[model samples]
Target chain A: MTVETLLLVAAALFGIGVYGALSQQSFVMIMMGLELMLSGAILATGTLWAMAAGGTPKGQLLAIVLVTVMAVEMAIGFALVVNVYRIRKADITEKLKTLRG
Target chain B: MTDVLFWIMSGISVLSAWRVFRTDSMVRAAYWLMVSFAAVAVILVLLSAEFLGLVLLLMLAGEMTIMAVFMVMFMMNPAGLNPMTMVHQHRAAIAAGVLSFLGLGAVGVFGRFPAGVSFATRDVTARLGMELLNDSMLIFQTAGVTLLATMIGALAIASRRGRYGLADEDSIEPAVENSQNAGEGPPSTEKGSA
Candidate 1:
């Protein structure tokens, strides 16, 4: 109903996303977390556009850019995951220690 | 009426996002994420961003399906037949999540944002189109190029064969002196001496 309410909801989504990203071992699950975080960002941006930005097209454009970023991130992330899985029979974060060096 | 719908969609998005990490099955997690996205799209529409909301739905449908397929392909327990806790540092993560939420929520509540309401009758989609083709044209073209590059890069990374050899195999360029041999065939498949 109000901008604050929408923003609070956005914050909640972002928080849950943080938990998911940090706690999950699976790469896909971690990505899901990032996606959730971006979802929050989109919602917040839309709320601001509707309530505070006087319906400016730039706010919506920003949201669209965020969406595009999400797509690029997902594409590259899955590609890396597939590659890693192919090279080593593992997908969890713990097993990616070889990447540290 | 709109207030009720807003609250409902907000609840749906948050709950489904929470469910994404809680579910054991990878497919369930991915689809749960999809549900969360769908609910957020509804909220966007309620906020009068009809075009953006619809586009979100369209983009996510394909993306989430791919995610589900990838989960099934790579996860050890795709169906979560065996209960497993594949997490570490759970307490710290929870603390961080809560703290970040509190901080952000406080900002949202306390921050003095400008007060302006969008007119419901305005054709936002047309305005957005004009913006894209006018002042924002460069940014729009840049995004298109970026997406094209991402597609090519993803393909190159995921493909089995690369410029030199099989991606899984140790790939090394053939020695320059061996040009005669290299010229006779497809990029040498021989695993180069490391």
Candidate 2:
């Protein structure tokens, strides 16, 4: 398949991820949505890399870095979630109504 | 052959992503997300990005496992046992998502891209590393430092016991022992009583 087709798929995945992040109440599900968005970004970068002049490796490298960043992001984010659960005893984002102001 | 593989991987990735958000339990959702990432990794491999595909698999698998463990340890709900409803404020989100997808797809399909180029060499991984290191080794080092900071920060935040505190001081064992001792009559009080 062409790079354009891959870009289209990535765009679709990104859109779905954004929808999940905005609509889902569960914190873990929201994180899952964010992961989907990152996955789309990785695909788009890889496709661009494959299409670049002189077959640029920069895009692939960037994708590698992004995968690492996503891992670290998930680690820290879940750590924070654990701390929040300890204090609040709830995992649902909607239940964080204490900050509704 | 390549086209068929691409279609299959794409379908698997998208379906698993949908499953991630649709599942009621957080642990199940995390596992579904892992499956989605694995499918995407396969797609990356098909694109000849072998290094990136393997890295994606390793990173996402580790992440999903950690998330599942955190859910069991900290979330108020029982570990994968409690039933939940996965409801959402979905109308606006659905509209926005659909519109964005249509807009992007239209752009991708209609936009003019550079002329097609044939692959001259097969060592894509080596080419990728050379190009990456040549252009911006500084940025690569910076990313490494950022990851280090994340690791340290996560440990700082998640570690329950400080240097001075006892681990499990408030655990169930002490409470259960106290209750059992109370039931068995206060440790033979008649030894000192007249």
Candidate 3:
């Protein structure tokens, strides 16, 4: 039951993140979507670890590693956003089509 | 008691997630996202993943605060007060979202899990450390190196050049001329412009 509940929640979060990533025009919103996806992944990992027999500690370790990756990703992403804003004075993702072919 | 706590945390997580997306203001969204992360961390703790829960809370709080600051500093509408639509391609997004959600929900609801019981009584932090060093030491070290590289790369990309490139003899002259040419108080350039 717990595993089912956790999977459902993870699926819901992943769906929402995908929706946000596809729909949102702001860079920050896209980042938020990515964060949501990461959160779902973390939850899934921790829950699966808990439910596994012999308690797979590796899953929990991976979750911690993912959290660190998320932090680093946010740091780099925000810094890039700040740089883009400095250059173009805009933050909307749609307006960033200059590099698109 | 455990089930009740689980339900409460789950409610908070889902509600705060919805609020994060539904709110118009970025700051409000960040605040709601923080709440959602915190609630999820609490749920992780309930599942006997206390170390993972605390790490999630700390990492998410730091990330959200940095994101909020970036939003304030970079977004054209810093206050998030301007009536601007942020979403696009809504119909396709919603359709894809709903399809995936239904598909995943069906799988989760109907799939049969293994009958093995959970062993959740171990101390999470010690076991995690042991596993990291024992089975996945290389992966752990690689992740640490990757984080270091990311930090350095961020600094490299974001750092701005100082006034070394400017003509030292006529720097103030150009500024005065430009200001005088524009009859208004000053050119309405964005902040941080040279």
In angstroms and one decimal each, the interface RMSD of every candidate reads 4.5, 5.3, 5.2
The order of the candidates by TM-score, greatest first, is 1, 3, 2
Residue B108, candidate 1: Cα error in Å is 0.7
Tens digits of lDDT, candidate 1, B32-106 = 999999999999998889999999999999999999999999889998888787887899989988988998899
Categorize the docking of model 3.
acceptable
lDDT of 1 at A30: 88
What candidate 2 gets wrong by more than 4 Å, as runs, is: A52-54, A98-101, B74-83, B162-194
Model 3 lDDT per residue over B1-194, tens place:
98888888877887787777787778878878899889889988988888889877877777788778876766666566776767899989878767766777676677776647665785767878888888899888888888999888887667665345422222223233444656665555843385
Candidate 2 falls in which docking quality class? acceptable
Q: What is the TM-score of each candidate against the true structure?
A: 0.90, 0.81, 0.84
DockQ of each: 0.50, 0.37, 0.46
- Per-candidate Cα lDDT values, in order, are 0.88, 0.74, 0.75
**Candidate 1 lDDT by residue in tens digits, A1-101:** 88889999999999998888888888988899889889989999998988998888988999999999999999999999988778765688876655521
lDDT of 2 by residue, A1-101 (tens): 88678888887888888888888777776787788888888887777666644456766767878887787878788877765565455577765655311
Which candidate would rank higher by lDDT, 1 or 3? Answer: 1
Which CAPRI category fits model 1? medium
Chain A only: TM-score per candidate: 0.96, 0.90, 0.91
